[model samples]
Target: MSSAEKGLRATGLCREFAGRDGSVRKAVDGVDLVVRPGELVSVLGPNGAGKTTTVRMLTGLLLPTSGSITVGGYDMVRQRRRAALACGFSLGGDTGLYPRLTAQQNLSFFGMMYGLRGDRLERRAARLLEEVDLADRAKDAVGSFSRGMKQRLHLARALLHDPAVLILDEPSAGLDPQSAASMRALVARLTGEGRSILLTTHDMREAEELSDRIVLMMGGRIRTESTAADLRLAAADRLGHVVNVAFADGRVPAELEHCPGILGEERDGGTVTLRVTDGAASVEWILKTFPGRTTSVSVTPPTLEEVFLDLVAAS
Candidate 1:
């Protein structure tokens, strides 16, 4: 699809800042990213990995040193207002909302800023309050809400304009497990309604569960991009599967390492750990080879955390 037809697109995106000592720092290097209609793309990275910088550039909140951004066909730099109208972002922190204002008032204020008026603004705000499950707290001051509640309000405010694309920066950053789960459910529901989303977060499990695709960033550049399942498979292919075997007498057989599918082996106390190309096949071999000597065995596939760590280390 064409750039304009796409939900959001950025090409050669870069941002730089001058250090206190007069040296130039590239907060974001050249990075190209896209989120198609109805797709939720998660940008995963460690702290200082350019995620926030990229998001800011995409949202037109910060100017890029070089490159271009398009939101629903409008150039984010040259046609900033139109692009801004096409996208809404929930950038968590203490800055986005008026803490002293009620939730409804905040939404009304932003809605007016978006050129919404009268009945249209009120209806939209009401719908969003219910959508974010904050209908009962609509009149409560934002400063009185919990972090999770505030986040929900942030989401509601972002949706006030009913933009085609949503940018969420660590939506569940400091939320408790239950609160995080609620946020995730809200995200899932939004995407289900065919809204495109660009989510930047360090939460690996959340990315793995919610994203249609994941872009792994490191040191201001895109390290790799893939579907969650593909990334996990790649990790398993590169690092192999982990197999733990227990022995009855606390002794591991020396010849186990030489098995066909066994790539590496280590012994720790009564447990023997094996890295194998084919976990099931290797386990079968081990069971048959050791017979009555083996007491128990377990195999685990590569986790998303393991994959993310390996990719970051390599980068």
Candidate 2:
């Protein structure tokens, strides 16, 4: 099959769990997602937003309550065992790696499970260890590895089988800055090799930097989905460009609140906070209307955190 045909696709996948009092909680509610060949998609959500649940369903670890999913053109539920071999997944925690096994041994074991043996397995394991910068530590017991080292090993394990699709949940959850950067670069390389990846992360910077598209989930539902630029643009229009105005006379700009598109305003001492809806127009008006009274102005660009907070708060 073509790479695109071998990509991951899901439609209305839902997972409901039984709760106390016999009530059903829809942890993953009718979620639809797709990952194209050579693309990196990020699923962004707060804790308990079903991000992990979604990954589990996609990776065939958990069966969905409803809806259909296909990975490498195989039914996720019906052909689960076969589908599992066609995809690689790395989840949070240690992923149950053999503590006594050396790094190369660990990779060799997983590669063997995927039907690789002998020189081929050893070569792949050696290459992966080198790719992840752990070749020197190939013979070190996993127990002696740092958190970041373990994280890299987990990734190496995922790719040992050369699966067509990858599913990762919080891949860099507890890594240092350097490790996280390396992890991201590795992900980029995987996509460069035409592998489709679905990743869940709580890191806004990671999501913004790696994702071709971001899906934001809340309360077991998709809140919104957009590219990073589009999200930033929406946030700017909704909350407007923040301008910090310094008043020379120590009095609130008399006509500040009267400006059109001024959504909200606050004054603290001689500083004024104006939430402008039309950032450019409102800023121009401020300059013309309060030229002499305003001493300085600074604009604060909306961050991913701010956009997410406003979205959640409003919902």
Candidate 3:
């Protein structure tokens, strides 16, 4: 895609910090990222993996030590104001909102900063409050709002300027399951409206479910980028196949212990789970060794969590 058509792009992004021990540390190192129009791309990494640092630089909150950022065809560093207008950021937590102000007041205040005025500001604030399901509590103090409510309000504040690109830093952090689900649904809806999103989260399942593409970061650098499905498949290839078998009488089969193609086995109650290199060969040998002993069998693929763990371990 052309530069003008791209929602967000960064090249050779890097950040360095002065360590307390009198040395320079690289917080982010030579990372390149892209978010297409209407696509939701997640940066998945553990704490200190530079996810937050990358988001900060992308949103023009922190200048990169090296490299460039462009949002909606505007250079983030040189055209800071234009880049800010094209992008909105919701850094999850209670840091961005006023504790004493009502939800509507908070949105209105942010709208004014975006140069919105009079009826337009009021209308935008009202619409966003309703959009984030905070309209009913628009008059209530933000300090009294629940964590989920505050998070939703933060998202509403981000939309005040109707930005083409949205940047979220751990949007569901510290939320309960239901609240996290609600946040995910809202994010999905935003992408459906052709808004490009760049999300940073440590939750692998969240990334797997919500993102169109996953960028795995580790040790302050991008390790790999692919779809969640492809990463899981790669994990399966690396970890091998898993076969689970259960017997009717909860009895362990002694002969199956000697079965070929079984790399390892675990017995939990009546069920036997085998980690094998060749699933088909292992299953065949297992049934042959234990004839009528097996009551049910299942072969399962690796999950995204497994892939993430394996990738982290290898890195």
- Give the Cα error of residue 208 in candidate 1, in Å: 0.2
TM-score of each candidate structure, all chains considered together: 0.87, 0.86, 0.90
lDDT of 2 by residue, 1-315 (tens): 655558898899999999889999999998988888888889988888888899989988899999998888888998887788889988856656888999988888888888889999999999989999999999999989988888889998998889989998888989999989989998888988888899999899998899888899988888898887788778897767777788888888567888878778889989988877776777788789888877887766577878887887887
Instruction: Report the poorest 10 consecutive residues by lDDT, candidate 3.
Output: 1-10
Give candidate 2 misplaced runs (Cα > 4 Å).
1-4, 243-275, 286-301
Please give the range of 10 consecutive residues that has the lowest summed lDDT in model 1: 1-10
User: By TM-score, highest first, what's the ranking?
Assistant: 3, 1, 2
Ranking of candidates on lDDT, top first: 1, 3, 2
Q: What overall lDDT, based on C-alpha atoms, would model 2 receive against the true structure?
A: 0.86
- For residues 1-315, what per-residue lDDT tens digits would candidate 3 score against the true structure? 474345999999999999899999999999999898889999988778999899999999999999999998899999999989999999979677999999999988899888898999999999999998999999999999999999999999998999999999889999999999999999999999888899988778889888999999998899999999888767776787788999988987788777666678999999989877677777888778778888998876577788888888898
Q: Rate the local accuracy (lDDT) of all candidates.
A: 0.89, 0.86, 0.89
Candidate 2: RMSD over Cα atoms? 3.5
**What stretches of model 3 exceed 4 Å from their correct place?**
1-5, 20-22, 246-252, 258-260, 280-296
Q: Name the TM-score of candidate 2.
A: 0.86
Residue pairs with colliding backbones in model 1 are none
